[model samples]
Target: MTHPGKPLIEVVNLEKDYPAGAGVLQALRGVSLSIAEGEFVAIMGASGSGKSTFMNLLGCLDRPTRGSYHLDGQDVSRLSSDQLAALRNREIGFVFQGFNLLPKLSALDNVALPLMYAGTGREARRRQAQAVLERVGLGERSHHTPLQLSGGQQQRVAIARALVTHPRIIFADEPTGNLDSETSRQVMDFFSQLNREEGITLVLVTHEADIAAYARRRIRFQDGRVVEDVAQAEVAA
Candidate 1:
């Protein structure tokens, strides 16, 4: 969780472009926004609207073509790839639709992999991984592999893996895309609980209105620019 009264994310004059055949393709165009700590924000847009690009920038998976990005009050726009990766490991957690769990590893080991990279001792990492699995309601399934679990259960393991890092913010990109309606709801409920109880900042990317409804704030993008940004109260009205 981040300190109160400070923005966890701040992007100013952000822009991204890719080279096309004898031309340039703009992905993000002068986008600017501030997201406070503990805020749950949903980013919505159609394909090619720059939603993924913006998320990549925010997640430190990719750098902006030109912009200023301050994450957790640190300016990350100028950081090197190694530096950004180190910061990402320390400050951010990511969940994807694919669930990306290692096939051969048991749920427990998969969740502990990040901590292993962080150089935790064998017993300490295992304990932390088990604790996160319990937090995600997968205490009894720690020995199971991804193939042994249901789709929903696999996603829970992925969530447990993300939480094991003790990240300050979580970025979920279409996390429920591969799940059924009921499973999606269950996952969203977990996300809501994490935010409310732990003060974890959450930013979710989705195209479905129902999924976006889980977030307290919604931001829409089109043509690489924000079309609408509104709070749930205003949206409800």
Candidate 2:
């Protein structure tokens, strides 16, 4: 079912396959779902269940072998590589488990990197990056490099980088995978705040049940298909 106003994501018969030694290796098989704007969703699965594959397809990092994917009502299943890159840059922000910051750049520069490709002026980029860094509670650490920061702080920098582009949707792959329990709580809180306050759609892949608890909707995958899709109230009941 799609949401009112407009669905931020809609997928149908989504499938993905890879080349095996001779035959094909099916990664995802006939998965379909929809997500609304401002919805927070948690995707869960055991390894090889195709949760990761589904996410890759949604993020446009990889193409599906078959099936259609509509993002924000646009059929993105057939966009060119350059078009996909541009669309991703303008509409989606990504938070990785490994905090993929450029090692040589300062936090500000790293956050500003996406804007440079968009041809943003130096001052505007600086202003936007600093604002997001401050929003993530790392304004004081803006001058530090990834190596110079704590793991939790580095993750915040990565989140700031994701937000600096002013994306409407965020795809976070295990956003708290490397943090301590307390730090993970903090990060999850930040995610909830962004979704509530800014109306940003968030879809995150997380294996931890407690982390998944934060999402309003939870989806589980098994053998490359959705095993469960339920709302938080129903799940609690």
Candidate 3:
């Protein structure tokens, strides 16, 4: 049950620190932002700029050293590890550059993995996974293993896997990093389509300006701080 025109993700004075040698390294310095529902945003920075660390915190893969994070109006920063895991399973989807698929599993099964984790029955999982695969234009490759599919097709399968959960938001980490220019465009186009048609919030982390250009909003990080956050004109999908 999604409510339009609401801030789907909100963070205040967010910070993270990691142990480095005898001291600590600050990865995020009082970062604060909100992502409205259905907005597509890209985070960009150089190496060690803390963009990845910010993404990790936003994705709930890591806990912040300080600050509050609210997802879907719930204070996720206070959730326990098990509760965080459950929340992630139900509310978030992820796409990665590596296409982290099981080598032996068919695309259908890989896409169905999340549903299986949520205790979905075999028949229901199959039905939902197939529907998403078809939506991603991979219906014909449903039975193929990751090793047998092209890089783009495998990424599409990964997209289907992310979509199968009907998540509130999707986080993509360098999702087009390994693809060629044309393939990258295709992937970005598909991401935009999803945001437009399904109203799925998207937060992408990438170092390339070209890749970031696909997003409607861009946030740039430098030295663990967001130095720039701006909205760009929409590009035709």
Candidate 4:
């Protein structure tokens, strides 16, 4: 459940545009939305509909060309690159479609990487990483390298890595895109469990209806703008 009053993410009149050879292409135009703490929100759109661009902005991976973004009440638009990096490290966790794990590193090491970068002590990082891996049901595979793990296990490690930092929000872009149907179901179930049990705000981007259905709220985009925002209760019947 969301907290009484605080919003985890807020966007106001957000816009992003790129200059082409002959003209400018707008990826997002005057989009505004807010996500409260512990909300599981899904963003859905067709190709070139600007969902990816919006996710980039929301994740602090890119800046908006116009307007403002407040993440956990901090004005992200006003932050410098260094400050943005710090904020990202401190507040955001990312799970991508591809399990971008280091081939040479063991699952535990991969999970510990973020905390290590945050200047955490080695022992503490290892302990936290191990706890997260166990939480994600990957404790038995902690020492295995990516190549040695199944796709689902690898993705679990990726999720463990993301959660080890104890982020305020988790941004998952097609997290189940590469998994088999059963694995996808498993992963989605884990996401649901995390949201319900841990109160982590989840933002998922996907093209699949079934995947989007896992989220409590859905937002659809078209021509660089939100065309619909519906609660799952409304969608079910």
**Best candidate, TM-score-wise?**
3
**Backbone collisions counted per model:** 0, 0, 0, 0
lDDT of 3 by residue, 6-125 (tens): 898999999999999999999999999899999999999998999999988888888999999999898887889888887777889999989898889999999999998889999999
The Cα local distance difference test for each model comes to 0.91, 0.90, 0.91, 0.91
Which pairs clash in the backbone of model 4? Answer: none
Better of 1 and 2 by TM-score: 2
The TM-score measured for candidate 1 stands at 0.95
Best lDDT among the predictions, by candidate number: 3
Backbone clash pairs for candidate 2 read: none
Q: Which stretches of candidate 3 lie above 4 Å from their native place?
A: 1-4
Per-prediction TM-score, please?
0.95, 0.96, 0.96, 0.95
lDDT measured at residue 204 in model 3 versus the true structure, 0 to 100: 96
lDDT of 4: 0.91
Write candidate 2's Cα lDDT for 106-125 as tens digits: 99999999999778999999
lDDT of 1 at 190: 93
Model 3 clash count equals 0
